[model samples]
Target chain A: MDFFQTIIALLESTIRLSVPLIFAALAGLYTERAGVFDIGLEGKMLGAAFAAGAVAAVTGSVFIGLLAAILISVLLSLVHGYASITQRGSQIVSGVAINFIVFGSTVILGEAWFRQGGRTPALSGDARFQTWDLPFADAVKDVPFIGPIYANLLSGHFLLTYLAFALVPISWWVLYRTRFGLRLRAVGENPGAVDTAGISVIWLRYRAVICCGILCGFAGAYLSLAMNAGFVKGMTAGKGYIALAALIFAKWRPVNIMLACLLFGFLDALAIRLQGNPLPLIGQVPVQLMQALPYILTVILLAGFIGKAIPPKAGGIPYVKER
Target chain B: MSNPYAKLPNWAEYGLIPLVNLVVAFLVAGLVVLLVGENPLNAAYHMVNGAFGRGEYIGFTLYYATTFIFTGLSVAVAFHAGLFNIGSEGQAYIGGIGVALACLWLDRTMPWFVVFPLAIIGSAAFGAMWAFLPGWLQAKRGSHIVITTIMFNFIASSLMVYLLTRVMKPLGSMATQTRTFEAGGQLPKLDWLLSIFGLNIGNAPFNVSFLLALLAAFGVWVLIWRTRFGYELRTMGHSPSAARYAGISETRITIIVMMISGGLAGMMALNPIMGEQFRMQLDFVQGAGFVGIAVALMGRSHPAGIIPAAILFGMLYQGGAEIAFEMPAISRDMIVIIQGLVILFAGALENMFRPAISRAFASFGQRSAAVQTKGA
Candidate 1:
């Protein structure tokens, strides 16, 4: 019973931790599906996190902060779109440049404005996203196994946490079922074909990148206003990259991305829980191993140690109408 | 509607375009400074004075440039073979282990000269091995080098932290770092090089690594421009299908290029571990590997160009510190902004101003031709 309780608690933390990864992975999905490879997800998240934290702290409104995050992320995404889509530049170089720009600008602006050595002031009530309990959560608290599962696992997440999970199915439906989804996927697989079919491939790519920006904004806001109290320096801390790994692990399917993120999050929660506690035979697990597991798994997946993880045919290649 | 890819005169291709990109990047950076409520010209003056105002400042700037030159060459080497090797950060981190191990084992017995050569081999070998798996996977298994190299970076970071905290920390020491090296592990300073000019290095950590970096740059220039192997790599980079038709072994070239690149990256550890710190410490690489990307792009992957590009970045690093000290509103992070802008304009948006410049040059040449015909 005690072990069951500990497992339940770990699962709860896993859900909470997986929220941002889910958002970022979905963001990657939108861009990659439109033939744009975005390694700048990290930069966008960090920039949005700083924007959200700064705005929330100043205006004392979480709603306004989220808007600012989305605006800033979308602006960065447009820059990327201009470089890769319109200018026919190297997508990888543009993404890398965005990461460096955000990594520097966040700290520079934060320190100049707040004077807290590259950190925003702490957020408080109303300025933060408060977690909400599901219906009957309190009513079923004293009940048995199923009750705890519903109350703990499914409830008690902040609004964006629920939104992140909800996005998985919505994204799947949008990508797989909608007419726009078919065109987006088609554009990724063969931009030349899309262009030949009388569609503006560049415009389609720009739209996909914009969708990516909006989702990444939510992920960043979740990091600062929902999960953490404020924007600490580099608070994203490679979660963006881990999300990219998860996206590849899932083969860019929305539902599979959610599962991969949960698995990575579970590893993280287990690592934190097992810090000093030694197991019967395996003994204490090194936290660094868990920290490095997502990257290791991604490399293995990319190497085809398991199933092959082929990306979009046109991914990372700029579309140029050559005569 | 004119041909955008038409060849230009050497001056415009090599000098004028890069100058325009650099100027635009600086203008954007200056705008950021203005938005932050600081005088752009004042900041610029301070940055230049800070980087070159004193002999010590010059020493410090050259010291930073030394690290950039090696890593920049690392990126350029792989780039010539049509590979994007982002794993230099990881390679450099693991290379530190090799340098530390060599020093830890032989510093008490071997002299500095003997240990230095062995440490170079150790660092290069370790760095190469770290990059080997990703290269092998790319060559043999068809995995993407960019993703694999990026993953390797995170793995290297975690591995280094585990090794530093769990294994390498001295007994009963509080810090998560190895013990300082003995005299044999430290490099002799090149203060005499400056003293020849009637100036002093003045407490700067400038050492012999700067000369080593210059020598490496020269070596890269020779290898890339004068060798059959260089021809093959450039062929493959320009068009892989053509190289395969010409009977160049794709797998072999890929793996060898990565090893050379990683080896260059690994040598960067010698500067920090032996020349500056005299010890192995955490994050000693300090994003120099990433800076290598910007340097390589700005230099157009030429060693002769890389040397100057490296010095420019070094000036930014040294000057940024001074600006942060003198101006309360601007921080050292501003240098990173400028670096990012340079990479964006010079690398990603390289052709932003090229078409316009090309058109202007095309019209001028045509007008001159008309004048010549009329005069004739």
Candidate 2:
């Protein structure tokens, strides 16, 4: 019974932890699918987190903060688009620059505005995203097994968390079923073909990038407004890169991305749990091993030790119309 | 039929365009300063005074520049082979392990010079080894170096944290770092060298690493431009198919270039570890690996450009610290904004002004030609 409760608690933590990864990975999915590889997902998410936290603190409204987050992330995404798509620059360089820019600008602006050493004031009341209680959560809490699974494991979460899980199927449907999705995929695989088919590849890529911006905004909002009380300097840490790794581990597939994120999230939750705990055979488990597992697995996957994770054919290459 | 914009002269290509981009980047940074409600000119004054006003300030700037030069060359060397070695951060981190091991083991027994050479070899070998898998995978298994290197960075960080906490930390010590090194591990300060100019680098961490960095820059210049292998590397970078047709082994070149890059990155540990801290501590690399990318990009991957670009960045680092001290509103992160702008303008948007400048130069040349012909 204790083991069962522990497992449920770990799973719940995993769900909460995986929310940001899902949003960022899905963001990368959209952008990469449109042939623009955005390593700046980290930067965009970070900028959005700062914007959401600062605006929420100022306006006392979570909705306005979300809007500001999306707006800021989208602006950053457009800068990336201008550099990578229109200017035909190196996508990686542009992405790297964006990361540095956002990383620096967030702290600079935060300090200037708040006088809080690169942090917004602690949010409270309506300024933060409150978790939602699913229907019958209270009634089902007393029941066993399935009751705990439904109520404890799945019930209490931010609205964005539920939306993140829902977006997985929505993303799959959009990518596999919609014409826009086909064009976006086509652009990633072969932009020339998409262009030859009378579609403006540039416009398609811009739209995809915008979608990435919107999703990254949600990820940022989830980080500051939900998972955390306020924006802390370098709060995103390497979650964006981990999301990228997860995206690759999942082979850019929507449903697979969620699973990969969950696996990583589980590792994160386990790492926290095993900090001082000693196992039977292994004795005291080093938390760093768990922290490093996702990256090591991703690298192994990339090296084809497990299986190959091939990226989009035209992912990093800037599209150039042959004269 | 003569299109002036089609063919650029050497001066304009290397000098004018970079200058314009740099100026634009600085302008954008200045705008940010203004937005923060500070006088841009006043901030600039403070930054310049902070970086270069005193001998110690110069020492600190050069010390920072020393690290940048090594990492910058690391990036440049790999870049010339068309390999983006993003794993330098990881390589440098692991290289710290090498330096730590060498200093810990040999510092008590050997002299400073003997330990220095061994430390260099240890750092280079370990850093190279850390990068070898990614390079090998790229060459042999078609794995992307960028993603693999980025992953390696996280792994390296985790490994370091574990090592520092569980293994390296002196028994019963509260800190996460290893014990300070003996005399053999310490790099002598360059005060004597600075004294020649009637200056003292008082309390600055500036040391022999600065000279080693300059030497490395020279070595890189010779390697990239004067060596037969460099010719082949450049061939592969410019046109891989042509390189293959020319009988250059793609796999060999890729792996070797990555190792060289990794080795260069690994050497960056010498400055901070042996020269400054004299002990292995966590987070010592401190994003210098990423700064190298910016330095290499701004420098056009040439040693001649990299040296000055590194100094510029060093000035930014030292001076920005001063700005943060003087101004209550502006923070040190302001330097990060400028660094980002520099990368954005000089790297990604490098050609933003090319068309207009080429057109102007082209028309100007045409008019001069017309005048010369008329004179003739």
Q: TM-score of every model?
A: 0.98, 0.98
Residues B240-313, candidate 2: write the lDDT tens digits.
99999999999999999899899999999999999999999999999999999999999999999999999999
Q: What is the DockQ of candidate 2?
A: 0.67
Candidate 1: pairs in clash: none
Could you give the CAPRI-style class of model 1? Answer: medium
lDDT of 1 by residue, B184-298 (tens): 8999989999889877899888888888899989988888899999899999898899999999999999998899899889999999999999889988999999999999998
Every model's TM-score on chain B: 0.98, 0.97
On a 0 to 100 scale, what is the lDDT of residue A230 in model 2? 89
Candidate 2 chain B: worst 10 consecutive residues by lDDT?
B1-10
Estimate every model's Cα lDDT from 0 to 1: 0.92, 0.93
C-alpha DockQ for predicted model 1: 0.68
- For model 1, what is the C-alpha lDDT against the true structure? 0.92
